[model samples]
Target chain A: MAIEKVEYWRWTESNWKNPDIPDWHGSLITAGVDIGSTSTQAVILADGVPYAYSNMRTGSNSPDSAISAINWAMKDTGLTLEDITYTIGTGYGRVNVPFSNKTVTEITCHAKGANYIYGPTVRTILDMGGQDCKAIHCDEKGTVTSFMMNDKCAAGTGRGMEVIANLLAVSVEDIGELSFKVDEEPAPVSSTCVIFAKSEATKLMRSGWTKEKVLAAYCHAMALRVVRLLERNGMELDFAITGGIAKNVGVTRRIENIMGIKALTPTMDTQIAGALGAALIAKELVEKKRAKEG
Target chain B: MIANYGYEDGSGHYYIKIDTSKCAECTAKGCISACPEKLFATELDDFDDEVVLIKEDARNTLQTNCARCKANGEKEPCRQACESDAISFSW
Candidate 1:
């Protein structure tokens, strides 16, 4: 069957507001904007607590995407750009956030965000983003101790999965479930490159291979690719995954099984880890300024 | 034969340039072990010589993966290890 021209991997945008946040009428408000290659996230914090957040697809302009994300986050909260005491930008477009007071690397931000969501015990973080993957080791306070990243290749990232979804005409969200329906776990694709894998998948399809089997092969390859990165950095306990791929059960399950350890479940949307961490940093910066002034 | 690794994105341009001529003369491939992120490997180039090159998976992420060294004002480990002065970063 010929695949239709559709963005099968485009996930829905979402926004959330923490109900427990007390009124921030006079309190410090901070925001973090993470403009990733494929998505943008904005997180608002009121006195260092998560107040509101928005996740959306990134558009052509990095600065514009950052602004749009933050605006969407602030929409229902009755907050505006002027209300923010500080702003920190992170992710691939950290330097492009025009309004940010500071910019933090996504590594540091992801560590801090994982600490907040998974608790301070999280020592290992694997963030599988749209175009890259990162294996980060952090201290109890979420300060990065060591880290490695894979961005030159697209084989083991969310983009890789999207390629497969487009090829198979399957929804990206359903690829995980469909991959498990195969009678047996197929051997992973031979190539570690996404381009080669796509060609290989095409050959398999032409040879009468089922879509489920092809998906299983691709997912397994992605899991193994990430496992190599994690092992190179020396995996520690209290591991967590923070990124779009964290929602993929197929890849996550295989990673857990291969490592013989379970990842800590995130309490919030995984994609917001970097932005949330940036917001937390913004709060700290604001408090530091206040103390200096006082 | 210069090899450039990295990509241009909305944020900025990040590239790691390797002078293959300098690399061709080097007998010891120290860069492969010098990088903590294991971003380097040896490959046979068109000249049929074993030269050190940045791994394909690390090209686009040079700035991020090298943050520690960059922030500390320390020379990049790979560049420091290359006695031939073959590796240079464009951040």
Candidate 2:
């Protein structure tokens, strides 16, 4: 089913329900946690509106990382962990979340978060994370219809950027910012594998290619691969790109040029879409319980 | 202490030896799932219908550089995930 086109607020501090608005849950709150390969994130929602968020470097164990993230977020709001009505977990490590009352797939969580932020009209999501890259297709109600995921490769994920960051002696955050300064796009990278791509980038640098050009090419190649993934999944307009890569403006701009659609990225660009979706699910579960008790 | 040996060929010779045996215990076949190149494949032999090793060349695949799959040479995920303890890392 095609989603209805509509304009959405990237961030508005909860239009759904807020403390100033009637029917706001002043005390009722829910939480969501996402445990990814490199980082873990948590989000707290009050009456279906985001109130607090936290992200941190993940520990060796996924469960430990998830728990710590939640704890950190709760502390930010000065709320005890037990004050959370329901907790939901989503990501590759969702099943390992001991505090979670339910576990959902990252696919569903991403779709839900994208829909909530960008409206249900979003048909595609290009999510480039630490260890996985995915292009997902969703229906009107934010249900995932189909998806293409690359979990075993680092070519199109943030890990690729990290490798390049190391080669350039710069932080990963600087790669995209530096890419924006390029005067001319460099030669396209030949290999999609991380090792080969790094070698190709090194060779380009040795060939007198400017760092700007090389970095731009890296962003270009990533966008190219994501575009191909979208095409493979059957591209539909009104697309939104989330995950860690969305924070990279250089890559996001190139992807927009290739796909020919403005990709929506929320202000909380690094705020873990999967965690937001889990919190939304948890909110729904809490509301159902309240209704049942009434 | 267990001896930790590595190969320059990037073929994951150690992972393969451990995974083949661990899969006999776990239902998800993690070694198969975790291997990017899928170097370790399971198939029936040509001469007989019995299963045999179907080695795949992973040189060109993405698994060549995944150093974290084995992760610091401690208890391997494929080995720890194994319920039967059929797999072992040996020099």
Q: Give lDDT tens digits, candidate 1, residues A161-224.
A: 9889988989999988898999999999843688989999999999999999999999998999
Best by lDDT: 1
Interface RMSD of each: 12.4, 16.5
Give the runs in model 1 whose Cα sits over 4 Å from its true position: A1-5, B1-91
Q: How displaced is residue A180 in candidate 1, in Å?
A: 0.9
Candidate number with greatest TM-score: 1
- Put down candidate 2 lDDT per residue, A1-294, tens digits, no spaces: 998743221111111222344333476788889887766788888777777777776678888888778877766465777788899888878878998998876777888888887787888888788877777777877776656665545877877877877787666766778897867776567425778889999999998988788888888888887776667557886788888778788789888888778976574544468898889878877887889999
Candidate 2 total steric clashes? 0
DockQ score of the complex predicted as candidate 2: 0.03
DockQ of structure 1: 0.08
In candidate 1, how many clashes are counted?
A: 0
TM-score of each: 0.78, 0.70
